[model samples]
Target: MKFKDYYQALGLERGASEADIKKAYRKLAHQYHPDVSKDPQGEEKFKALAEAYATLKDPEKRAAYDNLGQRSSGEQFTPPPDWQQRYKTDAAGFDDVDLADIFAAFSQAGGRQRQDMPRPGQDYEIAAWVTLEQIFRGGEIEVGAELPEYDQNGLPHRVAHVFKITIPNGAADGQRLRLAGQGGHGVNGGRAGDLYVVLAVQPHPLYRVSGRDLYLDLPLAPWEAVLGGNIEIPTLAGPVALNIKPGTLAGQKLRLAKRGLGNRDGSTGALYAVVRIDVPNQVSPREQVLYEQLAANSTFQPRAHFATGAGA
Candidate 1:
């Protein structure tokens, strides 16, 4: 359960005035709202955007969240000290908004099984760039969401909130997660739109992802390519050992089935090891002599037929 910081999620300064918060929310909401935009993740961004605004728009609720000491450590967004103080022990002026309703927002729009159904409010969405490791195993995240604000007269307002989102194990890039009732405000008992989360996994230094499979560039020594042995390689799951077959060559890919990134239909991806032979920059004289001998015996021709076909 990641804590969501509405202010940070909405990309606002903590001390931003209500007017500033409202303006920002409108700009972003219009840009990301699914009904109006097509950001691939517009709906999810829109819902989160709206929910953030809803939370921060109300001074009392925002104040409660703000003072709860709900800190943000990447994915640990929480309220500030005395968070309980923000809520009234008993319903007073806000019987319209209560804790149960807030939690229900978590399921307002439902799951992948049903997104087209009319919701209480408009849904919002956004993309999150995460590390490959986080995808291999479940983890939490912090998202900066922008929300709208308004006056008693029903005018728009501005403010930002940060929220922590949970990432499930074996999640794929572009995969979505729904947070109900996190979308637009309900009207006449209708539920608000659900908040959807789409993941954008960043490329790892040692891993290249293709579908559910991961590829690694494993540098091999000249001897290792000829003699073959186990070598260290990195994968989305973690570092692992890959066996090098004797006489291995460049462009050769070996598969570690089901060792990739996400599940195929329901499990996990596969891992492929791409072999690359390394040439020593500072070779020993003895090694250089050996290479010279090897080169003498090498009958390999790289571009043997270009001379015959001179069309260009």
Candidate 2:
């Protein structure tokens, strides 16, 4: 097998921190994973990513591979002298992982230990967005996922297929949902892998969701604000008329019951509809003359407070 430069492929510096490596991997994985990505070489790139991760995720093997340099590009990977003595030691500070699993491939290729290598099926990621209604109702979202074909030895042949997904309700943005046994094919009778769906909720044009409560910008007519009447307000469910008290002003908020998002603690939040009176364009000649006559009787000044701060 031809050796790949894991760091370059991952867009990382040799001196990159572990957190940096993890962040880079997450980004590249999202870009190359077959399910969400339509890149022509997504499958190929994903497999290469899996291979690179399999190496970089292991601190010992990563240290060794980082030192390999040009010697790795040859058909077979023959480690330089003292490679085993150099990296054969178990890693410190790494818990819950076995170093043997990562280096087994190299060993099977005659680097160190002669153990059978069973590569893990690759993992996949997808990004999805949901509407507030969908978030409340919870339903299946069909997405196209393509997985690469694998060789007998478990390396990828760069072939894939599209698959769908069913998303649940109340899913927040940046959430990841996993589908088991849906990743790259396994090798040597190993088990198939898994797929992940990443959530990306698009912002609503009128409503801003905070936790379970939703805030809406409700446009009201000037007469509606001044005279108080039932005005149609938009909600996640649909449009409903809300009673606006007489002499209502801009920037006032009305709280509606049972209209916010569902919370995890078995309670729902209230939706706040903020009021903003809109002025009419091109008034009728008679109405314009009436307004001019009404101005003489009206002593109200909306910007009376402006002069208080004018000289300060």
Candidate 3:
């Protein structure tokens, strides 16, 4: 069988401490984890690293591996007669057995007590897209994911799971809602892991949100902008009357208190109506004549500062 050098795979020496082994595994695992890595061989490298760490992290497995003596990585070698007799395994016709499998058998034989010990499962995080309306009011959303489940032999397998998560009122964008004991299943008598649902607010057709504030574009005619009157504006709740001040300019914001998103602390955000003056596409002859009369009679100089070249 070809021998694998677990210490070499982890870039550690035979005499390295347990803390060093854990630290090295964590660093390499983060870099090569299949979900986040961009390397072409990341999956293969990650599996190798995991296998190496799995054996080295355990005292009994490490002792069994160390008994095999030092050999160059991938070099063909035979296990010592004493090592085979200790494990009570006949090495005859076992050439195809991988080095990892050999350690698995060794662990099964020597680490039965360790295997029965409780071990907590891994936690998982999933992103969920929520609508603005849902954020305004508490609601439920469904999400599906694959979680790990350990079999009778202590082998992990992926199992599909569906969960309905409750989104609380005033749940902010990017907030994580944790569901206790909903992640990977635990082994032995350990507790299951938690599932974190991360919220991502979907883009709205009529409103833009910042914190809890809502901004909506309010279009008004020239006369309405100049005359100042009550106008109906649409909110998430329904249409509400908004008072427009006379001579309101474009790009001005009119605030409506407590009309935005609700907060968990029983507070509410403000809604701003952004003013936009709109003109008719076509005007009648009488309207054109009236416009002409107003233009000739009005003394308004909107571009008066341009004449002084001060803002040119």
Q: What C-alpha lDDT values do all the predictions have?
A: 0.67, 0.68, 0.82
Backbone clash count for every predicted candidate, in the order shown = 62, 2, 0
Tens digits of lDDT, candidate 2, 95-189: 22222233434444334443445657667676666776777776777666555553343223333455565555446777788888887655546
- Report the number of the highest-lDDT candidate: 3
Per-residue alpha-carbon lDDT of candidate 1 for residues 1-312, written as tens digits (9 for 90 to 100): 245667776889888899988998999988998777979778777777777788788775676556545566235332222322333222222222322234333232223244445545556676778888887776788877654432343222234667788876568888887877766665445676777777888878888888777888778887899899987776655677878889898879888887876663577777888888898889899988988998999896655667677542
List, residue by residue over 136-243, the lDDT tens digit for candidate 3.
Answer: 877788988766554444434456888898878779888997989987666567888899888888899999998889999999999899999998998888889999
Distance (Å) between predicted and true CA of 109, model 1?
27
Query: In candidate 3, what residue range of length 10 has the lowest lDDT sum?
Result: 148-157
- Cα lDDT for residue 275, candidate 2: 87
Candidate 2 backbone overlaps, count: 2
Ranking by lDDT: 3, 2, 1
lDDT winner between 1 and 2, please give it: 2
Off by over 4 Å in 2: 1-115, 153-155, 158-164, 185-192, 305-312
Q: State, as a TM-score between 0 and 1, how close model 1 is to the true structure.
A: 0.54
- All candidates: TM-score: 0.54, 0.60, 0.61
Candidate 1 vs candidate 3: the lDDT winner is 3
Model 1 CA deviation exceeding 4 Å by range: 1-120, 149-151, 187-190, 264-266, 281-284, 297-312
